[model samples]
Target: MAGENVLVAVEGRRLQLSNLDKVLYPSDGFTKGEVIDYYSRVAPVLLPHLAGRPLTMRRYPDGVDGQSFYEKNAARHAPDWVRTVTVDTPGSSTGAETLDFAVVDDLPTLVWAAQMASLELHIPQWTVGPRGGRNNPDRLVFDLDPGPPATIVECCRVALLLREKLRADGLEPVAKTSGSKGMQLYCTVTTTAPKQAWGYAKELAEQLAAEHPGLIVARMAKNLRPRKVFIDWSQNHEYKTTVAPYSLRARERPTVSTPITWAEVESCREPGDLVFTADDVLDRVDEHGDLFKPLLRKKNPPKLTALKSR
Candidate 1:
């Protein structure tokens, strides 16, 4: 199966895909072909969120039960048609000052990445400028992680509180399941410096943690997180990335980072209520038509500066 290949044409591009029968999710018996199919169907909505952003892929060459690695540098053997951007990585661990990262802006690129078993695709808040430079972040994100005794139920509570605060600041927020143990909140913003965005998120998180000391933990200490939600504001950093919406996570099953409605968050009573599989996501997309699409609006988005000094 590993050596077998299927040649297909996608949007005038020819690609050779392999190992379609290989089971990537052993528990679900989900194969590589299914993974590609999922991406294909979801591409219409998924591509906009990924366009022009540098991507960090989580690869599972041997399946979810096997070893995996993060791929920041585009594969040397990647097709010449694959677009990439070389960015500076100051104080690099591998001693390279810069890395060439893949930009998945089209359906063909998405399929090729799936063929390599890149189950999770991670991206930052900013998009690359037309001139190959980094633009200011156009969105801000809050990664709400739950500690051991805590779960999505608790994350939902914190999310509701964040919604109130964000709305008061004139910014609208949207919710999404992390496809792991927690959830995330995203808000569109006028192009703002990453440092400013990070500062706003950090201050807001600390403020909420102060108001609801028992329910939220703004700091990253493992001991402080017991039975509380850790509002990971640091994800707003320019170099940091959050899982792309609709991306499959490297979990025991093919869980997806799914966009959700506020009503669902308000009524979430158990962790199972928020968990979504790849199949579940496809169905929801057909019904909801990209609930997170509001984040893509470029007109008159609120500025993060209003809350920075609060």
Candidate 2:
């Protein structure tokens, strides 16, 4: 069944999907079909966060236990219908000045990526403008990564503190699990430069580290991270990308980067309390709707300048 293929119609577009029975998560026996199904069910909410943004696919063709690669350029064999944006990359690691990135704006595109085993979808905080220009970041993200001896419970404490700091700056932040070992906090911004967001996040992270020495670590140095959560403020950089919420992570199981409520964060006492599988996420969406919708609002987002005086 490895080479088995099935042709299906998605939104009137025909896609030749192959290896639906291939296990992408060996630990749980989760298959490629399940991955596509998960993306299909979550597309209504996930697509908005991905629209107009160039995506970087983390492909695990063989499975989570096998080799994986980060794909920034769109595949040459990609369907003609797949939308792509070509952007400049001056550094030229591959000796190419620009790369064509895929934009997963619809259900068919999402399923197509899933068929290729693109389990994780990553995107920058910025979006592509109507004229195919890169816009200033519309959101700020704080990726709370736990060091050793630390876990999601510790990340929860740091998230609570970040929520308060962001709120005081007049921005409403949402929390989501990293679907790995930590979590992230996101807040909307309006016309804020990337440098400004980076500086603001760094300042707040350092301030919290100083105030809560035992619970947080602001520096990226691995030695300083033990027993503390590292506030990855650097993710605000223009070129950096965070895993899109609702996207599945390449873990042994089908764990998803899920949006969560503050109440759950407040009550979390163990690491397992925050872990959510693909099925778990679908149920949450059914019950609570999209808690991360606030980040998608385009109007009247708080400006980063409000925190300049602080």
Candidate 3:
């Protein structure tokens, strides 16, 4: 491993072989030896968070033609923890690798995403926006997806309007870019406990969908959805997961998860717009700090319940 070629050199570090890395990263553009080398530099920054949890890794190869994404495994052919996942990049042949590391559940998934984004200088974005979480309480998620030909400014307006709606409901929502097209508004609350969150998400989603017809739709049943943005509650399950922040999604060009401010969000007009990168995101960490930490400090045990009539 020490003598292998280097794929991504970051100066000083050590590498250890992990099953997740072997399957996700593979030996595509770089050989098994080369991957070990890059791992030497990256593992230290990544391991502390990865310890004790299972991970899902994705790999990218360099070529003029473009990149390809492959999941490590699937439940049908492999273990529950290791799986290959890809993002939907409309009309593009080459997609980027999307990796996630977690013990198995939403809270850890969220924690890993926030830490990875802050550590690797990447922005985190939620997709197929939903409101359910097994480890977290039921809440709302507004996915700010990029349109086929939409601008960041339009997305921002959508988010601010969402913010207003959430406030009207007396929910304190946290906003963040999905690292790709649009943004996500997560309503914070106690009780990350699974079923309760799912119930809450269901009621909230139904309420919002009914009031904001055309603007939102309940996405529980896939076959019915067409052009509307889905308020997905499926992500609330204990085993379900989303791509973590800072993980390079397999695309023609590697796009990382990015974080943005509500003020910055107000000034934008397109989904493909942003001013963050892996190297500059730490500055964001310093300025805004981690958004998930406050939840961990609470001891007031959550009183989880749906605002809507069950």
Candidate 4:
């Protein structure tokens, strides 16, 4: 696939783009071109984090509210130059199946995905190694989902508490808005295996919940976590994926999963205080650069010790 119906040359690579005028977000009147433009502008910092990590696309062919689907297979229409990594999927009665996930490594591929109307980009904690070798967990994620009446503000409080605990354990953690209603906290940890990461996260969450029953709930069942923000440490597992930082969420509007400073988190009194749109994120990148970049290039891994068993 040399080139076909090229929209324009993106980073010296001719990319065929489509549906530039389609209004993806009817509420906000956001068009497909805007999404492509946002991805293009953020590509410099975003690409490094996603270089080896395969993406699970949350495709909104029509819009955010319209029917959408999560796609694992890179479309056959994708250019042969576009890279793909095959991953093993859990088996059923039949057997296991191999799935190909897109590895977004450049501006052209990012625009190509945006052209497909991929609104929400999902990535796993671990990244696939070179030559289809073993994958390793590079980042540990905690997805904070607040229950009714417990807004993003509450999630921030919980994140702050978790952050301190992680700091105490010699880990440097950071927080970001999930671009939806919640918040996500991440730390660069020494754990390379997904199972090890998952177990460590489980232990941390469970201990925290036990320490602060009124504030945090570590349980996964929705029923068990009434009036409490659930610390979804389960995202550390092998199969699950978290929203890639700096990605636009498929919300009512184009909200971005913007990286934030700890001071901002502490001062945020309202949930909307930390909410950022696509334009806001672009401005942030221009001013502050990649706040989440250090996580990818951390020199020292996090230090962890056995919990006291709360």
Task: Indicate which candidate wins on lDDT.
Answer: 1
Query: lDDT tens digits, residues 69-110, model 3?
Result: 443322333224322233322333333233232332322232
Each prediction's RMSD over C-alphas, in Å, is 1.1, 1.2, 9.9, 3.1
User: Candidate 2's C-alpha lDDT?
Assistant: 0.91
Better by lDDT, candidate 4 or 1: 1
Tens-digit lDDT track for model 2 on 118-145?
9999999899976668888888999999
Residue 87 miss distance in model 3 (angstroms): 24
lDDT over C-alpha atoms for residue 47 of model 3: 36
After superposition, candidate 1 runs with Cα above 4 Å error: 306-310
Model 4 lDDT-worst window of ten:
1-10
Tens digit of lDDT per residue, candidate 4, span 1-310? 2122446887788877777878898899998889998898888878887788888889999898789988878856577777888887776232548777788888788888898899999998877777755476878889999988889988988998898888877778878899999989998877645587788788899988999999899997878776799999899888888999999999999999989988899998987799999999999989989999768765777644455532
Q: Over the stretch 82-159, how does candidate 1's per-residue lDDT look in tens digits?
A: 999887777667778888888999999999889889999999999887666998888889999999889999999999
Could you tell me which residue pairs clash in candidate 4? none
The C-alpha stretches of model 2 lying farther than 4 A from their native spots are 306-308
lDDT for each candidate structure: 0.92, 0.91, 0.43, 0.84
The CA lDDT at 178 in model 3 is 54
Pairs with steric clashes in candidate 1: none
Superposed by TM-score, candidate 1 places the C-alpha of residue 52 at a distance from the truth, in angstroms, of 1.0
TM per prediction: 0.97, 0.97, 0.56, 0.94
Which whole-number lDDT from 0 to 100 does residue 218 have in model 4?
94
Predicted structure 2, TM vs. truth: 0.97
